[model samples]
Target: MSWQIWFVYGLVALAVLLFFSGRVRLDLTAALVIIALAVSGILTPAEAVSGFGNPLVMLIAGLFIVSEGLARTGVASAVGVKIAALGGRSERRLILLLMPVVAVLSAVMSSTGVVALFVPVVLTLAREAGLPPARLLMPLAIAALIGGMLTLIGTPPNLVVNRALIDAGRDGFAFFDFTLIGGCILLLAIGFLLTLGMRLLPQRTSAPSDDRHRRLHEFAEHYGIGDQLRSLRIQAESALVGKTVGEAAMRREHGLTVIALQRGRWLSSLNPVLVNTRLQADDVLIVVGRPETIATQTTDLRLSDQGFPHGLQRRYRESFGAAETLVVPGSPLVGKTLAQANLRARQRINVLAMRRADKPLEIDFQDTQLQSGDLLLVAGSWSDLERLTGPRTDMVLLQMPAELADRTWHANQAPWAVLITLLMLFAMATQVTSNLVAVMLAAFFMVVTRCVEMNEAYRSMNWQSLVLIAGMLPLADALAKTGGADQIVNGLSALFAGHGVYVILVGLFLLTSLLSQFISNTATTVLIAPIALNLALGLGYSPQAFMMTVAIAASTAFATPVASPVNILVLAPGQYRFSDFVKVGVPLQMLALAVTVLLVPLVFPLTRT
Candidate 1:
């Protein structure tokens, strides 16, 4: 082999190491690979950057917006509520119903989004059903992963493989081409999860019920802040009468946190607490501090302590709400102090308190640097709280007060969102337009119809995934350009020289599935697709069977918590250890392999037509 092929292989090895190390971001690693390829003169600048303009990237972005439309307009939440009602406290029935529902949803939307939508619902169901969350969450994650195999656009790996076919001057896969095989695998997984998989899961203690939907007073008591929450009226002679919250320095000087303000006679109308909010002579301040400190401040500041009113909880619930949010890994907010995040200004919400690993932080936590898995108690208007439920990188909504269940922000547009999604599917399935055109139109309609706002459409795009895909495409191009792909395919062929094609298929599936257990499956698919295609052509067989095998193998990221983002999303909530995934996931991975080896040749035909 030439030095260029050796150099490309070295870069791939380093890239895989970086992915496994978890020290550098996946997208950054891809970007560095792109730079190395371009600067190494293995490929021209145009070839290196060609991936940015790939239709697959645009289609993925458009799908994200469409999925957000369903979420923002309450379509997905409605499905979750219906599932909860149908399951009704039976562990067996819940697993039976939940896995299929999640799988169906994952067929259309991103699997990660589908899991995020269902996590809170599944947690609530577990609590109500008297079952450990461990019993249900693993099924949910597995179903989601299998569901991606259900449609051509179901996962990025499918698209990567399809793009390889199209770029090779062959007809690309149709919308439902993957459905037959994917459907079979999903059924097999559902059965495994319902029986043996259920036994494999640990019956750990359930996640805390306090994280479920609760009333205001319940939330206060759970956080151990009930005694700290007090109401005081500002007297005319009070030094804080005309001062802003920032100017009064209540937290700095008095060690009190003003959480809400009531200005008018009707106590129900609570104004959002903000730094620029001014205090009036008769304003009632709902504050959080030690009881003794509050009493002392009442006298020193010339204010009257009007112990919390009988209807205070009701009034607070009507005007403001509280929720528990988990700071997810890789959040930009990680390592920033609460004061630096400025949630009150940016998100229109205030951080009331924080809990890390089930232990509450100190009172002076404003300057505390945040970390992943920190559960925060935040208070804000119902509208702002509703925004937290949307897709965000900084935090995941663990639970909201029950009052939000009846609150409808975009419920009216749900039918339109569903209609638009169905129409987009119809267009793609019927071949009326290209898949890319159909998806873009659906995204445009989602915005024009007010199902999702313009700004939200932009925010819904997962830029990191998109960049990673674009950046890694050039590496695949360089591999094929530098003859690296041919070398790998030849080695595999020689190793399996006397073995039948079925053995070769099983070998490729295992190799792809193993690589997927650590790195992004999409990147794994990008690097392996060209090699699979060339190997099949070299063996005088059709490429479709090999390409489909590669795609299915890439989605079998079931054997580890770090395998997929969906698995990591459930790791903490389910209280699962590394061995738990191996116990449950390895069997499922073998099941998928068996199904793929038996079905791929039948579905796509290994023999040249």
Candidate 2:
């Protein structure tokens, strides 16, 4: 290989290595590759930055904005609730109902977001049904994967391939051009999964159950305690000393309901709802009613507030302060304890509580390793609080005063915004307007109307995937420009020409599918589309047919966690083991392969070599 060829080969190798390593982020890795390509003269500065401008790249970014709007407006959540209701507290019913809903949503919006939004809801429903969450969550993940193959915009891979074809002077694929085959493959996968494949899933009965009641108790202990109750004492000489809580009329006189009664080493329940409960002397009544009412009842009982220093009493009020902040990934505070982060000393914000990834914090504050998604609670004035949190991506201000850190956020949008995005997507899909202009106009309107704020629009774009697509484009061009593609195509043509186009289609699909499992989807699409086009050119077959096969196979990464980021994303939340993907994905992989082989030739005629 020449130095240029070797350079291109090294770049591809380096990109794949860094992506799978998971130590460096995918976006950063893409940026490094772009910089390397520019410095090496493999691409001009314009070409290096061109990925950010690619039509397919913009399509991905624009769809993200739309999906974020839908997510904020609670449309997705509403759909999730309906599916859960329809599933009616049964695991098998849930799989049947929710899997299709999630798959369809993912086909239009985002596979990762669809799974992220629904996985928790499914888990909650499963817990309510007393089913192992493992059984439901893995199926949801696979469904998202299957759904992404259903449209041109369903996933990044298909869009990347579509753009590659357009760039090569072929008409771009319509939104549903490949949907017939992809949808059939999806149904087949789901059918097999529900009937026979589910039996292959390993049963897991050992996961921790949710303890919502206990969590609620901890919150009440922290926030609802009144100041007057801090000083209420039952002394040896007091009348309350020998009286049982019920006999003393503490519930009636003090207007306090005993939630938990502690007597030395044991706790007694006094709730009238608990049958056959009892009260004992020296037992402390953990009351829930009110503090002012208790103070009035104890006032005639002669309680003394002396003995403890007034300064010592003041310390309780001074120990903690509050501030509102958002959680950003890779923040120093993420996955750290309150004491470890020195949250009080360095930031002067008390660790009151946290909201994380659309869920309330259930982990113990002191013990919880703050992951990337956690929103923090800090104490400070508005100005100082903003000053502290403004630079931190991990912290966003919680605007609701009455709201606890546990509430799921519901972000509503202006209806006009959704209408405008729909109009743009429709025009682009129908070819009434080119996608490049459509996305640009849509992004502009969103900014003007404040649908997606300027900063958010900038932040929301997937720059890494954009860069990966652009960076590899020039390399693919370099290959074709240097006769590298012709060399490979000629070899492939000689080897497979006598075998026929079906064999050639299968060969290209397997190669693209295998490469996509390990590399960036866009990169795989860019790398393989040109080769597929070249092979078709050399063998007198339809390049469109070959290109469509690459597109389908590129999006169909079913058998491994590393096959797609969409698969890896749910791993932690679903608590999925690595083997989970293999168990469910193997059958789907075969199904997609069968569909591609059968459908591509019929759609795009293949001639004899």
Q: Model 2, residue 307: displacement in angstroms?
A: 47
Best model number under TM-score: 1
Clashes of each: 0, 18
Global lDDT of model 2: 0.59
Residue 564 of model 2, lDDT score = 60
**For candidate 1, lDDT tens digit of each residue in 538-563?**
78888899999999999999876657
Candidate 1: where are CA atoms >4 Å away?
Answer: 88-95, 102-184, 191-217, 220-408, 500-502, 511-587, 596-609
Score every model by TM-score: 0.54, 0.52
Listing every candidate in turn, what is its Cα RMSD in Å to the true structure after a full C-alpha superposition?
13.6, 15.2
lDDT of each: 0.80, 0.59
Q: Write down the TM-score for model 1.
A: 0.54
Error of 1 at 332 (Å): 39
